[model samples]
Structure formats: C-alpha cells, structure tokens
Target: MNITEVRVKLTEAKKNRLQAFCSITIDNDFVVRDLKIIEGYKGAFVAMPSRKLADKCPKCNSKNHLRSRFCNDCGAKLNDKRALGESGDESKGKFKLYADTAHPINSKCRDEIEQKVLAAYKEESEKAKQPGYKPPAMEVPDLDFDEDNTNS
Candidate 1:
C-alpha cells in the first residue's frame, strides 16, 4: 500500500519524550490517525495507534483498566497477580497497560510507515521554530458530518 499523505502535529512540551503525533493517508483513500512519534533512547520512532488495556472485573464483570486497584463499577479489590507482566516473563517489566490498535504485519511495512511518518514529523518540527508558525489541525475530519444543506 502506498502512503499518499502524512500530517504531523508537534508536541509543545520540550522536556517530554513524546515528540509529535501524525496521521497518514494511504493510497489517497484509506486514512489512519493518532500515530505517535516518540524520542526513545535510540532515536525518534513511530508508534502505531493503541488503546489502554483493560480486564473484566470479577465482581461486576465490568471492564476495568489493567493495574486498577479496585473495580470502577463494583469497587471491589482487584487481584494483584493480574497486574503481572504482559508476556508472562518474570524478568520483564510491569504489565503493559496498553496495546497497539493498528500495526504493520511485518518489519518491512513497519519500516516504510515509520520512515515516512518520522520524515514528516521532522519537517513539521522545523516549521514550528518559525516566529509565526501555527500548528495544523490534528483532528481527523469527521467523514459522517453532513456538509450540504439539511432540515429542508
């Protein structure tokens, strides 16, 4: 799939590791939004759109975020064991509370998307240094919003 366009929105805080957020249009038809550009220990990298992880509360069967001490709905104490490492490796860090919503299937595709997004992010970051530069609208346009005259 060919990437047609990439839009980047640089983050304001200079001290944070998060550098920017981006959206990409694929083949001028498919659009994906909310990709993050982070400054990791190695360098800037693109992270696919992801959502926070959650689990069902045993007491209420309500969805509560991972690492929660108590169920949001029932307020019952959660099992601490459930908060263990995501990969089940004892040596690994804390349980991941987030997972990627969309990601490339292979390293090749991942590299392509990451390269394109990071390039756009760099260009946008430079523009941000200009005196009158204003950030672009990061919000994805609502496709379902009716633009034509209505209530006729």
Candidate 2:
C-alpha cells in the first residue's frame, strides 16, 4: 500500500516521552490518525494508535480499565489482579493494557511507515524552528452529523 500523505503535529510538552502525533493517508483514499512519535531508549519510534483495555466490574457490571482501582460507574472496589493470568505473576504472564487499533501486518510495512513518518517529523520539526511557522491542522472530519441535518 502506498502512503500518499503524512501529517505530523509536534507536541507542546517537552518533558514527556511523546514527541508528536501524526496521521497517514493511504493511496489518497483512507486515513489513519493518532499515530505517535515517541522517544525510546534506542531512539525515536512510531507507535500505532491504540485503545485502553477494560473489563466489566463484578459488582455493577460497569466497564473499567485493567489498572483501575475502582469502578467508574459504581463505587465498588476493582480487583487489581483482574488483568493477571492464571499464575498471578505479571512478569510470568504479562497482560497488555492497551491494544493497537490499526497496525502494519508485517515488519516491512511497519518499517516503511516508520521511516516515512520519522522523516516527516524531522521536516516538521525544522519548520517549527523557522521565524514564522504555523503547525498544520490535524483535525478529523466530523462524520456524526451532516450540515443539512444539523438545523433540523
């Protein structure tokens, strides 16, 4: 798949490991947003968009994140070991608290995406250093309601 466009938005927080947020357009038809550029120990890397994993509370059946100490909808205390495996040792059988929403199926595709995104990030970073530079808008198109239906 050809990545036709890439957009990078540099993060404002300097202390954070997160460097920027990016979006990629594939073949000028599909768009994937929320890809992150993070500073890892080895260097910068691309992280695909992901969502927090959650489970229902035993008492209220309300959903809460795996790391939550208490339920959000109900005031019941959540099980800290809910995310653990049968061994009850996270190191032995670690459970992922986040799952990728969109990712490359193979290493080649992943590398390609990483290279392109990192290059765009470097370019954007340089642009930010200029005297009068404005960051590109990375707003997602609103698909929930149509303009004609809003007034009705």
Measured over all alpha carbons after superposition, the RMSD of each candidate to the real structure, in angstroms, is 10.1, 9.3
Using Cα atoms with residue i matched to residue i, what is each candidate's TM-score against the true structure?
0.83, 0.88
Candidate 1 TM-score over all chains jointly:
0.83
Give the winner by lDDT: 2
* Candidate 1: regions farther than 4 A off: 85-90, 140-152
Q: State which candidate has the highest TM-score.
A: 2
Against the true structure, candidate 2 has what lDDT?
Answer: 0.80
CA lDDT of each prediction against the hidden true structure: 0.76, 0.80
Worst window of 10 by summed lDDT in candidate 1: 143-152
- lDDT string for model 1 (79-128, tens) is 76675755556467445666777879998999899889988988898898
Ten consecutive residues with minimal summed lDDT in candidate 2? 143-152
For the record, the alpha-carbon RMSD of candidate 2 to the native fold, in angstroms, is 9.3
